[model samples]
Target: MDDASSQSRPSADQPNPFSAVPIEITISVGKARPLIRDLLKLGKDAVLPLDKRVDDAVELYVGERLIARGELEELEGDQQGQLAVRLTEVADLQDGLG
Candidate 1:
């Protein structure tokens, strides 16, 4: 009898069945550090300064592992004004995610 939970995965030579699986990619533009006293004094509109400038390439990560670096861009046409990433550097996945 075929066990539903024991189905075999596709061989390496076959098409990857998990290709459509979704993953969360985090974008790290920069970080800010503020004193606890200053943090407590925040009001309606607060602008925390980041270490990087607007043109700096942002780092992409899967969990804590850095995966790639890319520049921030705006979408055009139907997706106008939406944010997107233009990958500048990609990690060697064979080595690892970082």
Candidate 2:
């Protein structure tokens, strides 16, 4: 067999194998689990507190996997008053499912 035969071609259905792939990334500030009764009782002004403090680093998740930890920041210039995450710690790819 030749080297050309060993390599596979891209299928017509997917022009680029990595193209059009979707990933969901979420930056979690904190988490809270309230009782059903408490949840129902919450009104407009009610505050649901999170487990994390204001200074704590937020977790960055790809779907349900924890990919990195970052600090929240305010974007300026072109981003103008928008919020963004500044990655402080990144998870190692070699780490087993961590």
- Leading candidate by TM-score: 1
Off by over 4 Å in 2: 1-22, 96-98
Candidate 1 clash pair list: none
Cα lDDT tens digits, model 2, 1-98, are: 56775356666764867678987799999999999999999999999999999999999888777889999999999998899999988988568234
Give the poorly placed runs of model 1, Cα more than 4 Å off.
1-13, 96-98
Candidate 2 local lDDT, residue 41:
99
TM-score of 2: 0.74
lDDT per residue, candidate 1, 20-82, as tens digits? 999999999999998999999988899999999999999999998898999999999999999
lDDT to native, each model: 0.91, 0.86
| Model 1 weakest lDDT span, ten residues long | 3-12
Residue 17 lDDT, candidate 2, scale 0-100 = 73
